[model samples]
Target chain A: MIAFESVGKTYPDGTVAVADFDLEIASHESVVLVGTSGSGKTTLMRMVNRMVDPTQGRVTIDGEDVAATDPVALRRSVGYVMQASGLLPHRTVLDNIATVPVLRGTGKAQAHERAAELMEVVGLEESMASRYPSQLSGGQQQRVGVARALAADPNILLMDEPFGAVDPIVRAELQTELLRLQRELRKTIVFVTHDIDEAFLVGDRVVILKPGGHIAQIGTPEQILAEPADDFVRSFVGADRAERRLHLQQVAGREVVVDASGRAAGVLEQGGTP
Target chain B: MSWVSANLDTIAEQLLAHIAQALPAIVLAFVLALPIAKLANARGWLRGGLTGTAGLLYAIPSLPLFIVLPLMLGTSIRSPVNIVVALTIYGLALMVPSASEALRAVSRETLQAATAQGYAPWARFWRVELPLAGPALVAGLRVVVVSTVSLVTVGGVLGVPSLGMLFIDGFQRNITAEILTGIVLTAALALLLDALVVLGGRLALPWASGRAPRRRTAPRDTGQEAAR
Candidate 1:
């Protein structure tokens, strides 16, 4: 479990990045911190690894204060992913994935074998293992990034806009992949994204932050969509969310429940009314 | 050409001596420049001062440097060490900035990834930064080799054993054939060395080819080609 107790971060320039933030993420839960720019969503995620130290309060993982732990060791124990794949251009995909394991003194043969398995787990072909990150497309590179993060199999995965750099199609595909992986692995994940739809899709609980990293509401996606805490939360979720309330619509002679985007989202069961 | 053929043994000896002097200096300069360039990368003031010092060293005339190196080092004026030291200094002067630029060219994202992946700074420098810097570093080496090759000819003015002796002898004897031969041979040597550097770069950075897995088709378009 990760817990933040009245955590606040103020820059040396006297800018408040995160103010009076408190959150607790249970084990095996995927919690997303959602906000627009300047919301300090990224800052809150980074503070877990001591990449940004909180000035006012403490963050603990499994009840151990993260600030007291060695920074490198703490970072190694948590998996972190970023946008643009953040891959080493000179390294082959396999070597990139093998990096963390090898750093922890795992033998080369074992690390490479683990990397190969992870490539398959992350939906990349074995043939791509020898190719450099530059040789892969944006989507492929992101998958490699995910695989590399999972190579050491840390209990907590910190993802900061992991799919934000890819196209819409690839973004959806990676989200599905993440859902599948989460179901199987059940690792505690802290995800940060500006996309509300993505937060709803991937997060078990969404912590909506206002402009300066102060929580507006904390609830499940269904709860947030059903009952926005305030006007800002309602506006951020958008009016289209109400249309997501399932109602049968006629398309030609067939009836289907259309989603907010006017696409046929699903079909009603036999007894449900339009 | 006739003088060159008749005195082929002497010409060959001078050519070997030229290679002997230039190769070590180029290698030494390359080795030394890496740490200096890495230092320069981390600090702004050090980079500026070091690069400025290199530019000043490079701007000095080779003849003066060659003449004064023995005095500074307490070696005999006739020692080949003078030519070697002078040429090495020139190589370092030319290479330091290139090395800095090459290392700096590595993407910041890649470095951040390495750090997040738990690589210690030194390991990341060797495994990630240096390999990524290969193409630019080799390009720098090509410039250094060609410049050093030509500069070795100038050392002959100080009676250093090099191809430059042919130019002096040709000038003294008024043999245009000897001067022409020396010019041709030096140009050929420079081209050879440049080609070697390019080939070595290819060998070292096979992934830098930027080619996709080959498909058996006439007009297959790779994304990297389009990206360029």
Candidate 2:
């Protein structure tokens, strides 16, 4: 479980990034913080790993204040992914994945064995283990990043726009892979992104932040779609999109709901709520 | 050409002596520049000051430096040590900025990634930063090698037994052939040194060979390409 108690961050230049933010995330739940630029979603996510410490109030994981723990140890204990999929270009994919484990004093042989398994888990070819990150495509590099993050098997995973750099097709594939991984692992995840649709798709609960990292709304995707907390959220969630109407339309024979973007969003079973 | 052929053995001996003088300076300068670079990497003011000092050192005329170094080091001007010391100083001055810039060339994202993965600073510097900086460092090394080889010819002013001897002999006795031989040999030596550096870089950074397929496909249209 993670909790933010009156958490706020003000930069040295007197810019208030996050203010009066409060939230609780249950264990095994995937909570996404969604916002545009200046929403401080990245800053908020970074706090969990102590990359950006709060200037006021506190953040706790399972009732232990994160500020009290050694920053390096705290960071290593959490799985982190970023937009760049920051794999070290010099290290081979296998060594990159094995880094955290080796840093924590695991035997090199054992760590390498675990990294090989992680590469398989992240859907990378075993042959790629010896290749450098620079030799891989963007999607492949992102996969290596995921493999590296998961190598340590941390209970808390913090992802900041991990799929933002990929093409839309690749992004969808990675999203589905994350869903599959989540179903199997069930780690507590804090995801950050600017795309509302992504948050709705991947988040168990989405917390929408306004420009200053102040929460505009926090609810499940269905609840937010059914009832937006305010006008800002309505537009943010694209509630005006035809997909939110939830009306059943016959596609050949099966009833499906199509979004305003002309894509099929969901299918409705017979006599089910649209 | 006849002059070079007739005196092939003497030319060979001088070539060996020139290499003996130049190669050691290059090696020593490369070794010394690394620590200076590492120190100046993160601090802007320090890097600027060090680079400025190196620029000043480089601007000093080789003959004057060659003459002055013996006095400073308290060595005989006739001793080969004077030439070695001066050449080493030149190499250090030339390589300092190259080394620092090469170290800086490693991207911020890569460093952040290393930090996020819990790499202590020392480990990150050795295992991540230095390796990524390999290509740029090699490029710097090539420039220094070529420049040093060319500069060794100037040491003839001090009568430091080298390929430079041909220049001194050619000038005093009006032997155009000897001067030509010296110029040609010096140019060849520079090319040889540059090639060695290139080959060393290839060996060090095998992954750099085919690493940028994506960038190649979308090659940024710099104005030169458009103009062509």
Candidate 3:
């Protein structure tokens, strides 16, 4: 769980990035933050991992004020994925994924063992581990980025538009992979994106950010799609609210019958992801 | 001209003499530059000071550096020690920025990834930073070497009879063949050294292969987004 209390940030040059932003994230929850550029959504996310200290107010993860913790230590205690895939171009794929665990003081052998496990989770081939980020496709590099973030096995993961840099097809695939990973790992995730469909797809709680760092709406994707809180929320969510709803909705009649354990029985062809 | 061109055995002997003289000094230059480059790139206090110092050294003109350093070091005019110290200083002048800028230009995100992944600072430098910085470092080396070849001619003024001596002697004596031979050989050797750096860069940094021809999106991170 993460909490941001009255967080604000203003640069020395008089540019205000965030003003009095407050947010609470529940444990094991996937919260998607949607905003236009400079809405302070990413700044809010960085606060949880302590990458950027808040100029005002406090950010706590699981009730511990991150300011009290070493920013590096705090970061290791949480996960962070970036859009650039920020794969150290110098390191091989395996080494890049293993970076955090090693930094956390895990032995090389153990760190690599964990890295291989994560590479599998993110769908990276073992053979590709020896290659550098430069050698990878955009999608593959992002998977390594995800693996690297999870390397330390942090309780929470902060992803800043993790899939934004890849081609659309790869982006969609990564989005699906992310959802699947979240289901399995269940680490609390703060996903930031500008795309409405992405926020809808992965967020258990979708928080739409207003232009000036205030919350426009915070609710389940269903709630926001069915009833936006105000004009800003509706406009920000875009005019295709009905179509976006289709991606979130499930019709009972069209549902695929599954075993009691919820394993997939077959495709629910009658109803799509909506 | 005859000493270099007449006999295959003699040319080989001259080359061996040249390498014996050049190799240790070149290796020392790389060793010296690594740390200076790193310091210049990473340390805020060192950047300007190192840059300023190096620019001053670079502008000193090689002949003066060789002349001045020998007197400054209290060495005889013809000492190889003076020759090397001058060359090493000149190498650092160029290599410091080469290494630093190479390291600086490495994606900050990649470094964040390294640190986030729990890599200690030193480990990150070795495993991540150095490899990315390799191309630029080699580029710096190329500049150092070609200039060293030219500067060695200045050392000839100090009475060290190498190819540089041949050129300086040729210039004063107005012997076209000898001067031309030295100049031609120096250029040829400089090219050879450059080729070696490129080869070594490719070999040592196989991971640096391929230039992503695609235009990367100028990663648009809003003030909030940029922090992560």
Candidate 4:
């Protein structure tokens, strides 16, 4: 469990990034903080790993204050994925994945063995183990980034717009892969993204933020879609958009689900009527 | 042609002396420049101060430096140490700025990623920052190598023996062939050393040697492509 106790961050130059933000993330839950730029989603997520220390309050993991821990050791214990897929361009894929474990004092051979296994876990080929990051495609490089993040088998994963740089198809593929990995691994995940649809797809609960890290709304995607807390939430989530107005229509003797735009989304199953 | 054949032993001795002076100076300057450049890169004021000093040091003429340095070091006026020391200073003047720029060219994203992945500062420098800066550093080093080799000839004006002796003797005796030999051999030596530096860079930093393949393709079964 991770808890942010009235966490606030004000830069030395007097820019308030997050102001009195409070949230508790339960164990094994995937929470996505979705907001526009300057809303402090990335800043809040970084607070969990001590990347950004709060000026006015504290962040604790599993009832222990993160402030007392060494930042380097705390970072080694958690996984971080970011927008640019920041694999070391000079290191081979295997060596990049082995970075954390080696830093934590694991023997080179053992660390590499774990890295090779993680490559398979993250859907990378064995042949890619020896190739430098520059040789890989954008999607493949993201997979390597994911593998490197998972190298230490961390209990918590912090992903800040990890799929933002890839093409839409590859982004969707990576999203699906994350969902599958979450189902099996069950790590506590704090995901930050500006894409609401991505938040709905990957998060167990979505946090919609206004500027200065103020929460506009927080609920499961269904709850937020059904009853937006205010005008801001409604507009941010596009609850009034044509796409949200989905309905069933008869097409070729089968019931099909269509959006208000008349685009067919999927076929309605026969036996699963509510 | 008879003059060349007769002075073969002298030519060989001078060529060896030229290489001995040039090589050590090239190496020492590079070794010293890295840490100095790293220091200069740390802050704006330090960068300005250090590189500004190096640039001013480079502006002093070689013959004057060769003469002035012996007084400061208490070495003999004609000692080869004066040439080596003077050339090393010249090499540093060229190397420090380029090395600082090379280190700066490494992307911030990569450095932040290393930090997030639990790399200590020293580890990050050796593992990530240095290797990524390899191509640029090699380019800087080639400049140092060529210039160091060429500058060793200036020591001959101080009565030090090197390939430069041929030019001095040729000028006084009116043998144009000896002067031509000095110029040709000096240029050849510079080119030869420059080639070796390039070859060494290619061997050490194989990842930086070729154009990065932009599009993804199916993985190859063999590692031969990477070896290239």
Which model scores highest in DockQ?
Answer: 1
- Supply every candidate's count of residue pairs whose N, Cα or C atoms clash at under 3 angstroms: 0, 0, 8, 0
Over 4 Å off in model 3, which ranges?
A: A239-274, B1-56, B120-123, B166-192, B211-228
Q: Which digits, one per residue and each the tens of the lDDT, describe model 3 over residues A1-274?
A: 7899999888889888889988899999999999999898888887787777889999988788889987667777778888878777766788888877777778999988889988898887777767767666777878889998888878899899988877677777888888898888999999999988899999999999976678989999889978989888887886444333233224465554454444545545645576
TM-score of each: 0.90, 0.87, 0.80, 0.92
Name the lDDT value of residue A58 in candidate 3.
Answer: 94
For model 3 the local lDDT of residue A100 reads 74
What does candidate 4's lDDT look like per residue over A22-95, in tens digits?
89999999999999999999999999888789998999999999999998999999999988788888778898
lDDT of 1 by residue, B157-203 (tens): 87888888888888999999888877888899999999999989888
Candidate 4: lDDT over CA atoms?
0.90
- List iRMS (one decimal) for every candidate: 4.4, 8.2, 8.8, 7.7
Task: Quote the lDDT for A272 in model 3.
Answer: 52
Q: True interface contacts reproduced by each model, as a fraction?
A: 0.39, 0.34, 0.36, 0.39
Candidate order, lDDT descending: 4, 1, 2, 3
TM-score of model 1 (CA atoms): 0.90
Instruction: In angstroms, give how far residue B46 of model 3 lies from its true place.
Output: 8.4
The regions of model 4 sitting more than 4 angstroms off are A249-256, A270-274, B211-228
Question: What DockQ does candidate 3 score?
Answer: 0.26
Give candidate 4's error at residue B186 in angstroms.
Answer: 1.7
Tell me which of candidates 1 and 4 scores higher on TM-score: 4
Write one digit per residue (lDDT tens) for candidate 4, span B73-180.
Answer: 999999999999999999999999989999999999899888888787898899889889999999999999999998999889888999998898899899988998
